[model samples]
Target: MATSGDETTAVRGTFGFNAPAEVVFGVLTDPDRATRWLPVGVTAEPAPGGRLLVRGGGHRAEYDVDIDPDRLEVRWRPATGTGPHGSARVGDAPAGGSEVSAEVRAPLDEDRLRRLLGETVTHLRRDVEDNFNAG
Candidate 1:
């Protein structure tokens, strides 16, 4: 719920899936799945002072985590390009599925920011859901 007024600057969304937090967490943190959502290739060195270079998914923002920020919020982006900083947080849903919230800062027009964040969320949800269903 990030939409505020007729002109919002950031876009935040939450998605639920029929999977567990651990299951969905892997989808977001695993480097193998980086290309599925990240803007650029995965270059996280798995350390606190590691170098990260992500420039894909339309936007081109760049930032670093303080040694993985709970080992979950690894996604980063700069404000210059079209990139958005996003992360996936999973929790147990009352109905048994897992809830994943994606907080993205799209530094673009309201329309484009919303659209990009929405599409990114949908794609990630589908991928994780499909993976769960397949198992």
Candidate 2:
């Protein structure tokens, strides 16, 4: 994670999953599946105007969701004022699975931001691989 300006922290990471890009993207956009992989206790729901309402850990925010199925990319930003925002792009891994490049920016400390990003990515990979095997 890197600090931008004085307070904002930015985190960028890449993770690989043993699943297709489609599968990863599916899990990301589906509210039920998304909540499963998000940070523990976090909840996500579809909101009006194609936005996503997320609440957890005593924090609540609404984000505008943008998706590009063809590119296997998904992005979200605060629906109103700026706070925390992120984007993930899924691509076919040369070895056969999928690779995801993710970025998150928030006005939080570097350690906290890094921990949150790491936790979410770990959960996302576990949920995606587990569900892929189940199905």
Q: Give the local distance difference test score of model 1.
A: 0.57
- For model 2, the local distance difference test gives 0.86
Per-residue CA lDDT of model 1 for 2-107, tens digit only, reads 6444333666767777777766776766545545653223333232334344544442334554225354444555424444455556677876777776666644
The candidate maximizing lDDT is: 2
Residue by residue across 3-118, what tens digits does model 2's lDDT show? 58746788898988889888888887786677878888888988888888999889899989999988888889998888888899999987679989999998988888888888
Which stretches in model 1 have alpha-carbon errors above 4 Å? 1-8, 38-52, 57-62, 66-83
Pairs that clash in candidate 2: none
TM-score list, all predictions: 0.65, 0.92
Could you report the Cα RMSD, in angstroms, for every candidate shown? 4.9, 1.4
Highest TM-score against the true fold, candidate = 2
lDDT of 2 at 44: 91
Query: Model 1 compared with the native: what TM-score?
Result: 0.65
